[model samples]
Target: MSNSDSSTTKTNGDQFARKGMSNGHASGMGHATVEIQDGKTVVMDDGRKPPLAIVLKFVDVKHTVAIESRFSWSAKRPFQFKRQSAMEKEILHGITGSVMPGEVLAIMGPSGSGKTTFLNLMGGRALRGMSGNITYNDIKYNKALKRRMGFVTQDDVLFPNLTVRETLMYAALLRLPNSLTRSQKIKRAEDAIIELGLERCRDTVIGGPFLRGISGGERKRVSIGHEILTDPSLLFLDEPTSGLDSTTALRIIQVIKNIAQAGRTVLTTIHQPSSRLFYMFDKLILLSEGHPVYFGKANGAMDYYASIGLKPLIAMNPADFLLDIASGNVNDVSIPQELDKSALPNGNDEAIQPPAKDVREYLVNTFNQELAPQERAKLFALESTREELKLAISEKRLWSITWTQQFSILFIRGLKERRHEFLSWLRFVQCIAISLIVGCLWWRSKIQTEAQLSDQAGLVFFIAIFWGMFPLFTAIFTFPLERAMLAKERASDLYRLSAYFMARTLGDLPLDLVMPCIFILIVYFMTNLRVTAAAFFLTTLTVFLDVVTSQGLGFLIGAVMMDVKKATTLASIVMLAFMLTAGFFVQHIPVWMKWLKYVSFNYYVYKLLIKVQYSDGEVYDCGTGCQSVGTSPSFHGIQLGGGGMEAWALLLMVAIYRILAYIALRRMKTGG
Candidate 1:
């Protein structure tokens, strides 16, 4: 830890920045460069409004991850693979840094050097087992700070169906403060679209693995657009250029530079960047084994190491040199005589170099003794004026709109995104194919005899049960698939959970019923169940009710499990029980299980469907004489159906089950 870079440390190479950037690999970028400028003049805050100048400081930030061991050690055995034990391992050891407005800080490290952990801790996303003090403008992290910050995660968690413009517009509506008018929010979104250079793909859909849409670079830009819609004072991103090409990554870093130039304090983690990309950052923090090797001006990193007698044999990318140092791949570099001898590893053999672990420790110890205290004291001694303090504590309204407006916005957004899924050709074909098969098998049954009546009953049973399971499986994936996006949006306080849930359920209601309506319309006429208009409409209503109730059950299970395999397994078990007690295959349920049938919504819907098409006076021809179908053993010898009561039961379940599902989601931990 040379720790040569301090808050006031200035590299002696500023005059040569242009000369250096114009040579070698940097020349390939042409005129596009990320050069730090002596910033423009800025005014201090008045008491009326928050300060545009924001400085974020993180002090002694340490994170220890609680790992559950797959194997346990106990008195019974030396090691047991079947048992588990609790263990703690600190992934981040007192990571410290600060960023001022108009500056971009890049955190570079080896794969497991806690780059992302440090970013999250500084961003307040990973809260558990973290001990640290993070402040904005010298105030501790609070709701005001939270509302003023934006985070773009490594993997872009975006809705594949939404266009880039719609994505930014919705973010604008949801994240901007309520003080802004609708026109103002729209203007802000438009500015973001223009600023992020997404004008060409503004209408492009953000496609997923199965879909082809925008290019990777555009997707990353759209992510940045989402965060900057509110013009947050601080922006933190996790590996914005992870998978892009060299040109694209440079463009992204340029965009981040532009953002920082706009007075937003920006911090990002880089996965091994090229020299041109490395030169873009104003500040840099190099980590190895969760220890800070260097934190200061990015341009001065090489000079700092050179002062400590560690220099590359040949000219190399500053980022690569730092990574080589972090990885202990420095055989080509010259080591200081004092460090080589006085800070030697515990070994008699001096010809061989020390291991990477020992090198990391040596750097850590050096930083602790020589520089950590000064930096720590300097960071701890920061103080702000009364106006700046008020500006830091000032909080904007988190939700931009009223509850009703939020629901309406989410409703329309959901509708636009879900239209293609529900109305796709594959879904149409599935519904049409199943309905046609059922219709043809019971074609024109005409119920004049007991045999035809029996076929009618079978058709009702098939359609009712099939639609029940269909909506359930479809709805079950809603929360699980969207868990990531939901968490991300909710963490930013985009909308209330109630508004989101209501929009999700009610918004999908119209789309969900469209296919079912088409299916029932085709099959009902073909099967010739009942010719009366009232009976036909009533039958459609019953199926719709059954579909809705089953969907609610799926929501419950999905919310509780939140995993596809586990939720599917539980759904299967539950539906199996409902079917057995439905009195379809078995007339008399076990006495011990008699109470179970009342809980299954299928029990009531089955009888109601029969009553909708069949009447009490209706009789079927017997070999000996005529007999009442309603009283016959084939009908389970139970009262076939009653009006109003069974539908009420289904309606009640719809409300209760969905309410419980929403409650479950509320309990879920969405990181901030």
Candidate 2:
């Protein structure tokens, strides 16, 4: 009998014998051969057939994979540096599997069995060294496959702020071929929605955290819908049934099966399954310890188990039975290392091999016999060539919306939010009420005595500390409320960080200017510091400066912290430091510590206000007669000039603080 290897060669040779039989000149020339050289096809022809006429088409796509390691840990180690120290632990051993066109393959394993890891590698999420080959129609696949295949991550990454239609539209716009028109894009999106059964709530918004919109199942569908809109030939889903009830899970699978029947390939990893769910898969790939235990027809799994002399219990789940058999081998129980065809007396082994008279083989043999004519025809019909798919990630963002738009949206949204509204009103009311009550107690300084100087000092000290807290309080409250939303919006590419920051800074200005001015004016009139309008304006400006400075500082802290508790703590610490170095109270500070007063917002505002108020009023002093603690000689330094230095200091301090706050706000808004 002819050896199969030699027979294959002879078959190949004989197949090319009739290539040029139409004329005698090309009769003997039909004999030609093709061989692969240097990983490329090289055709050879004796003076017989035309060398250029010899052609061979081999499918070039492949699914090459190699994963040696994977480590899992919690949030404590964001980079997982420690995990790299131990490289010997291979979470996923070199796993290799592939499916051709019209093939359905399933990966079955127990929980944490690296099934998800395998899927992640296929999706290009898990980084790993890959070997072997995964070819599609003779073409070697690469990252370009991302365009031809769809990946559904474990998490349903949907935006809480957008409706289902909006979410799908955004993804479609980003992923769809640029050549498609707007109407075509919308049509594609609508088709996906209908296919995924999201039409019922297409207009409903997706919800998360404080935002509420759609149900979880609908959200999941939206996630899948986004991917399906791309119309990829290969779809990889990670636990599509996770978090869904069995009924819903079955429905999802049915949808997937429908997709598979429509000439696309779909593969997914599923955990424990009900009997109905188990039967849904076209092929079963049982895995254990990152090794394939069995990969073949799912219906034959039970018989395969029995063939190994492991009898399964009646009515048992076939998958569970096979898993038990694999698990039983964990202790290294001995079994035959190879299949022995001679040992099968009933010829069952030969039945497992390709049947010589099978209809499938007959069809394949006939197709090969007619391949020459088929190719000649296909050469004219093949029109799939087009521009290469290139994913151009945009760097210029949609965040360039003007400050007015950003401010309007943020303020309106902030006002609608219970947390921001409640905190803002409470703080505002507190400021107004305290100003009124303090005004009632220390009304229009009667008899402006020497004791009034002490009162003025007390008033200045209280003003610096209270005003310093304004920025701190605003930051603590605002940061705690909107930090999370900012992060979410940034991730979704909603707006530019700079624009958002600018808008927010501007938005709080009206309130900042109003609150401080009101409190300062109320106090100034009540105590009646000095009647000049310029002095009144200076006093009010100091209060405005305090609030404006605090608002900026609050924004910086809020932007920097991002976390509520952390930001609040940081803001508190900063406020305390500012108060200590304000130089408004306990004027006698260590010389080394005095320099801190220069940079303190509180110090600048306090100094400027005192300068303005003193400039407006006259202080009686007897030359060389004044005695004060720390004054070496009993003398007043040249009669003090009631100067207007406070006005200039107030402007300078406000400008500096606002600038710093703006920089911080920009960073926070952009997730920098």
Candidate 3:
């Protein structure tokens, strides 16, 4: 490899880059040569200029992948669904190309040519509808690698709550080893801050409709920093410079070029690069109608255009030039056929190396050809296994952080977030005050007669419904906001999802106890229920169970759905079913629906309230055959001690729901 001529030899991933490109591999490229006079630039074909750098490499597909799609309703409305029936139109036409390790490989095509689809395939974000052999460093496309490879999605997916530094730090901690001490992590985070030039406003907060965080550039840099923190070998950014000014865009390309020069691969799907950015790339891949028009070194890309009798103007983006050619926007220029060898520069006649048909075999042969047998054996010798790293990651999380950690963090964050919104807190306080005031207005109003008892039952029924819906309010509010951050951390394998769930569950206990405790205490005391110290405790316990169970239900919904609107819809359905089966208005429901009562959390909660409040005596009148409202004669076929056992069963039901919610929360976590 070292013995190759200067025109063919390229640098390995060693040493930093100088201004412009250090290699002279662009000698064969006619459009790459430039001249400078008194700091003014001029396009020239002198053949002595530097070649552009290569930032990434895509060798070849190792296996054939068959992609298929089907539709069920196409025949019913063929005209309406003709286009819809074929969701996938085979965008990438099984093209083969390689990008250099430090080059920006531009992928340009028309709107429907599958540019985004190709980018998604490269990023491993495509679903089962599409299939293809994608390899990185000769390894088949793996999702784990995608984690290390950052994809700046078309939309800037930034959390508006955190500052720029906080956002990057969180991403860093999640991706890097936790074994490093706090200071070490901070240093690493600081390094990224400096590299992306975000130090000016490191603590600037991001902004959104309800959130204020950082500037756009800072957010984008933070996104870039996240991928860099993992020391990723490759990066796939989609339209990174979009929505930015021309100057900012050029600067961003320069930064990316610097990043590539630092021995990492950075491939971005850009709309159009300025001339400056165009010169920054090492390769160009042009596509039309899902077919490759050209795939080669960037400097040589224009040469292919010139070969087809087309002359591109200076300072024009290569993508724009190619598009013009494809769309017939420019007159074609002709290439000299026979006299080019002698007429061109001396180095342009050098042979072009053929691309490897089998990347693995090529690499193997290269390795074998480069080293002696003894050196090859030594290189293959194993020093330490990846199991050690996994174990180390596991060990850092072995510390027994009790429920205290989760409860404390969640409670604090919840309070902070709730308070920051201000409107929600005011509404919540107002509702509690109003509910208490309403209960007081109806205090000691009845329970002496059947109609009076029915009113009391109505009150209890409303309370049960309210409690069942409590978690729904919270889950909808909190989950959507925090889900993105949690997902980012989980994708980096920060900690066990179980630990996060446990912490959240435990942390909310105190706040959960306080809020409902106050509400229940106010209503229980003011409404003039038979209030003994034991009765007060019992009622408070029931309210607490109600709130916790609601929270658990909400957590499960939020965790699974991630979308607040959908979660609310689902929670509403559950609440409605529980209300119907909970003996609200129906003493006898259908047998099938009766089975739902067993699983209905509202049923247990409301039934237990009746047993606790009215168990001692219901003031029976003249053998009128009083049936206690919301009471079950038997639970699991065992009569209550005046049904005190029923209260215990309700408690058990709450516990079970809490457990199931925890499981759901854990499953919602990212990496796990």
Clashes of each: 1, 26, 21
Write candidate 3's Cα lDDT for 1-672 as tens digits: 123421322232112222212321110111222332222223333222222221232332122235445544556776663322433345556445555445667776556555666776676555344544455544455444544466666556665656677666655554555466556666667766765667677877666766666655556667777666655556677777778777667666766676665445667777767767777788666655555556656677676556444565455666677665444244232223322222223476643322222222222333234322433244235222222112112212232233444344434444443444433577568668867776776686566565666667666766677777865577555556677756654554444566566665656566556566556767876677657887677767777777777777777777667788888898888878877876555777888788777777777777666656665334533236665433433222222335455566666765776677666666664443
Alpha carbon lDDT of each predicted model: 0.78, 0.54, 0.56
Candidate order by lDDT, highest to lowest?
1, 3, 2
- Candidate number with the higher TM-score (2 or 3): 3
Error of 2 at 672 (Å): 9.8
Lowest lDDT 10-residue stretch of candidate 2: 20-29
Give the CA lDDT, 0 to 100, for residue 149 in model 3.
Answer: 61
Off by over 4 Å in 1: 1-51, 69-84, 338-352, 392-397
Reference-based TM-score, model 3: 0.69
Clashing pairs in 1: 1-363
TM-score of each: 0.89, 0.52, 0.69
Model 2 spans > 4 angstroms off: 1-89, 98-214, 222-242, 248-567, 585-595, 608-614, 618-672
lDDT value, residue 381 of candidate 3? 51
Tens-digit lDDT track for model 1 on 1-672?
123531222212222223323321111111222222232222212111212557888887888998877854678875655657788998888877688877999999989899998888777778779887787776666555667778999999999999988888888888776788888787767766655556788888999999888999889888887887665778899999999998888878877776666557899999899999999999998898888988888998898788767799887888888998888766778777654664445477554555677667666777677666776787767655435333525555455679998999899999999999988999999989988988898888865566766677778788778878989998889999999999999877788889999999888889999988999889988888778998999998999999999999999999999998899999999999998987788876789987777888887788778778877787777666787778555556557557678888889999999999998888888652
lDDT of 2 by residue, 1-672 (tens): 224422211112223222211111011111234332222324444211111111111121122344445567769968764432333335554343444333445677766556777665555444444433343333444444455566665667654667788777655654555467666667667656655666678887787777778866666667666666654566677787788887777666665654444334667887766677778777676655554555556676656545553454456666565554444321122122232221223455332322212322222233234332443355335332211212222333433234554555555433333334334677778878999887876777632344555566557657767877865676556645665555544533444565556556666666556567768878878876767998787667667767777766776676666677888888787767666765444467788887776667776666555556563234432244533311211111212334355456656766666676666655554322
Error of 3 at 355 (Å): 33
Worst 10 residues of 1 by lDDT: 24-33
